[model samples]
Target: MLVALREWSYSRILLVAAFLSIAGCAAQLAPPYDKTVADGLNSANTEAMTLMAATSQGTDKNSFSAREDTYNALIGTLDALALSAGARPMPKNRFTDAINKVLEKRGGKPIDDDDSTPPSAHSIKKIAETLTKMRDTDKKQGVTAIEAQAFKGQLVIYFDQAITYENFLQR
Candidate 1:
C-alpha cells in the first residue's frame, strides 16, 4: 500500500512539472507600436475605399487590378508587423534552460511562428480576413459596397484600439 501511494505522488509531481514546462514554450512575437504600421493600414484602407466605390457603381471591375499590387504590399507589411508583435520573451527558468540545451545538442528547432496565425487573439485576424476577401477576384468572393463600408468601420475601430494599445505599452 505504501509503495502504491509513493508511486501516485511521484506521478502527480511529474504531471504538474510537465504542464508548467509546456506552458512556457510559446514565446512567439514582439512590440507592435509604430506609426508606420498605422500608415500602412491607412493605405490599405484607401485602396479598399476605391474598390468599394467602383464596386458600388457596378463599373471598372478591371481597374481593380491596377490597385492590386498596392493592396497586396500593404497586406504583406501588416502580416510582417503582426508576426513581430506575436513574439514573446524566452522563458528563463531551469526547465526551459534544460530543454534548450537538449534541443541544441540534438540539432533540433527551438521555436516556430506561424505567419498565418495572428500574433494575438485580438482584432487583427478579423481585419486580415476582411482585407483578403475584399481583394478576391471571384464574383462570389467579392464583397458588396455595403460590406466594404462596414469593413472600413471595423478598420476605424481597430485603429482606435491600436492607438490605445500603443499608449498603454509606452507606459
Candidate 2:
C-alpha cells in the first residue's frame, strides 16, 4: 500500500510539472493582450465596412478622386496597426531561423524578415495592400459593385484574421 501511494505521488508530481511547463510556454508564444489593439481592430473594421458600402455603387463608386484621401487614410491606419503589432516581442522559432540562413546563402531575400513578423502584423500588411489595389482600381475604370463586394470580402477576411489573432493572444 505504501509503494502504491509513492507511485501515485510521483505520477501526480509529473502531471503537475507538465502542466506548469505548458502554462509557461503559452506566454512565450505571443505578446500579452492589449486592449487598445483590440479596440483599434474593431474600429478599423467598422470604418472599412462603411467606406466600402458607400463606394460600392452609384456616384461614389467611381469617385476615386474624391475618395482618394479616405483610401489613403485607411491604408495609413492599417500600416500603423502593422507597425504596432510588429513592435511586440515574439520569440523566434528555431526551424525558421535555420530556414532563413539557407535562404540567405542562396542569395534570396528571406521572406518576412525570417518570419519574425507576428501573424497580426502580416495580416494587417496584406489588408493595406488589398486596399491599395482597390484604390488603384477605383482610379482606373472604377470598381464595379461586384468588384467592390469582392474587395470588401477580402478585407473582411483579413480583418477577421487579425482580430481573431489578437483575441487569441488574450487567452
Candidate 3:
C-alpha cells in the first residue's frame, strides 16, 4: 500500500511538469509583433500598390507583356508579407481579408469570355469611386487602421489619374 501511494504521487508531479513545459513552449512560439514586423508589412503594402498601379497602366496601354510582369510582382509582394507575418506567427487572415476586400471593391470579378477586355474608362472611374467609398467605410469601422490610411492616399492618386485617362480615352 505504501509503495503504490509513492508511485502515484511521482506520476502526478511528472504530468504537471510536462504540462507546464508544453505551455511555456507555446508561449515562446507566438510572441507579439515588434517594430520589424510592422515595418515589413508597410513595405510590402507599398510594393503591392506599386505593382497594382503598374498593372493598371499596362491594361490601359493594352500591353499584355506588362500585365503579366505587374501581376507577378504584386503576387510576390503579397507572398513575402504572408511569410513574414507567419514567421512572427501573427494572424495573417485579417491582413489577407483586408486585401481581398480592397480588390473586390476595385471591380474584382472572375475573368470570362464576356469580360476579356478591362473595364471601360467610365467603368474604371466608377470602380475608383467605389474604392474610395469602401476606404471611407473601413475608416469608419475602425478596422485596418494602417491599411485605411495608406489606401486613402492611394485612392486619391488613382482617382486623379483615372479621370485624366478617361478624358484621354474620350478624345
Model 3 C-alpha lDDT per residue in residues 52-169, reported as the tens digit of each score: 4443322232334434454454445444443443343323344445664676678768323322222222333343344444334433442244544555466546445433433333
User: Best candidate per lDDT, number?
Assistant: 2
Clashes of 3: 0
lDDT of 1 at 2: 100
Q: Residue by residue across 1-171, what tens digits does model 2's lDDT show?
A: 999999999999999999897664532545778778778888888989988889766334445678889889989988888899888877666545666588787986645453566788888899999999988878877887888888989999999999999998887
Q: Which pairs clash in model 1? A: 28-86, 28-87, 29-86, 29-87, 29-88, 30-87
lDDT leaderboard ranking: 2, 1, 3
lDDT of 1 at 77: 58
**Candidate that scores best on TM-score:** 2
Error of 2 at 133 (Å): 0.7
* lDDT agreement with native, every candidate: 0.56, 0.81, 0.44
User: What is the overall TM-score of model 3 with all chains considered together?
Assistant: 0.29
lDDT of 1 by residue, 1-171 (tens): 999999999999999999897884655233434555445555655655564565553323456666577557656755665544444333355665577578767877645543332333144445565666666642344455666667667766765564455444442
Error of 3 at 130 (Å): 16
Model 2 accuracy (lDDT, Cα): 0.81
Counted clashes in each candidate structure: 6, 0, 0
